[model samples]
Target: GPQIHRRTLLLTAYSGPVFFHILFYYCQAFIYGTTFQHTASQILAFTLITLHFAKRIFETIFVHVFYRLTVSFYSLYLYLFHYWLLSGVFMAYYIYYPGTCSSSISLLSSALETEETSLYFLSAVWIFAELSNFETHLILANLRIRYPRPIPKGYGFDLVSCPNYFFELLAWTVITLITRSLASLLFLIAAGLHMWRKAARKHEMYKKEFGSQYPKYRKVLIPYV
Candidate 1:
């Protein structure tokens, strides 16, 4: 299996949306405005999605420490294709094709507009989760730099072994709440399940490294969930 740099992999994953979504929106707004009307919901959704990917790209380069983390090219391609492109298609269908005979798609736009107060609250929660996740990554990166066995503690990490994953799940949960998109909800569920399994594996590794010293109260992805 040929290996690819984690940084390269992450950059590619995020770059897909930054490139495709922007182009998609531009064409929909300027080039094809006669065919597609740009609504507030679509603009907001696009901003939120693009900002999410931009934050990821920034964090992958500046916050996370790649170290010797190299994954197979197949794994990279799987993630890039499944998440970046496929997810974009799902989002585009809901956002851009509102008049395409789907009541559910029409409902998504209405949900965002109708739930103004709830959306604002959820946006705050999302921002907090994003910052918390970034802070957790910084803690882990610094721990690695200091050559210490990484034992995440405090903040979101006080309860879950993978607080970053926890916050990530929360962030997506908020996004689903704001957009009310079935596609994003489904994606969140799938990603949360995958993160849960990975967190359990990581917790076991911590146990192997620290033995009884590992936090016994710490759960895997969520606390007592």
Candidate 2:
């Protein structure tokens, strides 16, 4: 019944950003010619985006229990392609054209300048979502450790069947809001749809596995919404 190794899928998906980010870094100097500029906004976006993928790689390698799940090669290819396309478009567009959204990087060089309450609020929300997501992952990983085959619970699980998915969606939404890029917004929509379906499938499976013992009040993905 096994098709492709889960580690293969995970490493392939996460390695994509390393390739694309390097390509973009070099191309920036070549295209823009020596005067390769990095703005504050650009730096912020880069740090956040890079950290996001790095965390995913770390979690996949250490936190997730994927040994039992068999994924097709085609599915791995699809994962790589989708992330590459989205991440490529986002990094290229945002880093190169920092002036396109919100304020220019120079003007927003310091918090004192271009004092915006909304930016801080969105950033706070983003950090919160990321930390919460990581906590959920830890819980999931611990569950697998305690049981041969674990059922994920705790944290957001008390409300929704897939708290990780919901938090992931929220994190991306915050990044999209921070960037105010339509491209990123579209990526969020696509990712959200995928997560929604994944959560539904997971919920169905839980019901089949646990029968009526599964939480009756749990939503598929979102909590109370």
Candidate 3:
């Protein structure tokens, strides 16, 4: 049953990214007039995203539903596990073949476009966002589950509440900057804001529920409050 459940979760995670990739390929072909090589590269990116998403969803469903894991534990597992995989893969690629992971659009060009400072800055921001997100998850896990065994009060208030949404927003914002595509930027911005609003509501819920017991944390979109 556990194995079957894990498989289902993996499918759910993979489906979204696969759908996004197909959509992205068609859109790029229509809008940007991408060549066959460019389309193929986009397909590869799609596969990477799909793999990451599948692992995340599998951990989430398996830990929470099958094993009766705590929210914090599952959240930490999902968040950290995905980033670890992504960062590891990215680092390996970057180290082994320095310039190979650059824009796929220029794969077939005689002279590939040089790297811009903005691209570097964007990549830095992405790394920071991932670190911050993983740290938040770790903190939440420790606060909610690792300390005392089944403390009911811990669940009443969130520790570093809504950090997932915040970090995700920042990550997507960086992605937009890196990609520099209007469609991608718009999608990220729209999705980020939507998640921001949802996180704010969650904060309000925690405050209402826990009152003074909730941590005296700043309520900014980013950690800088």
Candidate 4:
């Protein structure tokens, strides 16, 4: 009981920092608006922070109850991977089509030469992310319904290995593209590295635990056919 309680407390405290940052940034956004470039950074920062906190909170509050344990490795992977890929893409776009805003309020103005292109790209990214998110949830639900207990030995292949991590990465990649700031890019990279390591660890654990019986079908980071 103490171990379980300690685990829960650790999860909550680990995520509390990001949650606090989200609240702080949100309050600042409301007060300052988005007319200035600084506000753009603020928005991006808060968005990243919120996403991190939300992912952790969801896993802590719901996934544990539904799935019987926190998806610790998956959560880390999702948080970092999405941000890294998206931030790189956004940085590239920013270099090619640089624009300036007078203030946070004017940040959304269509004043850049490639405004239309950027908008279209962002929309497409959002749509893709949402689709991925939906698919991931579907997979998770299927796993929980079909395989309730100690995942069948070697049957891990049928389980939704790490669908959430894949989609989570995709979502942040889109976010980085939408808000191409150096700060955002840095954050993404930092988060990505952290998560990648965790994913690797999880992969190793599954392999060791399941041995040859583990579904040969399931890949660590991707879905196994």
Best by TM-score: 1
Expressed as tens digits, the lDDT of each residue in 1-225 for candidate 4 is 112343364354546545445433434345334422333434443454356556555655554435344445444544344433333333322322224221232243345435445545555665665556555555455555673334422222355355556555666565555555564456556656665666667667667776786566666554553
TM-score of each prediction: 0.85, 0.83, 0.52, 0.50
lDDT of 3: 0.47
Q: After superposition, how far is residue 49 of candidate 4 from its true place, in Å?
A: 6.7
Worst 10 residues of 1 by lDDT: 100-109
Please count the clashing residue pairs in each candidate, in the order shown. 0, 0, 0, 12
Model 2 stretches astray by more than 4 angstroms = 25-27, 32-36, 67-70, 89-91, 102-117, 148-151
CA deviation > 4 Å runs, candidate 4: 1-59, 66-114, 130-160, 215-218, 222-225
Each model's lDDT: 0.73, 0.73, 0.47, 0.48
User: Which pairs clash inside model 1?
Assistant: none
Displacement of the residue 71 alpha carbon in candidate 2, Å: 2.1
Model 1 whole-model lDDT (C-alpha atoms): 0.73
Global Cα RMSD, each model: 3.6, 3.8, 10.5, 8.6
What is the model-wide C-alpha lDDT for candidate 2? Answer: 0.73
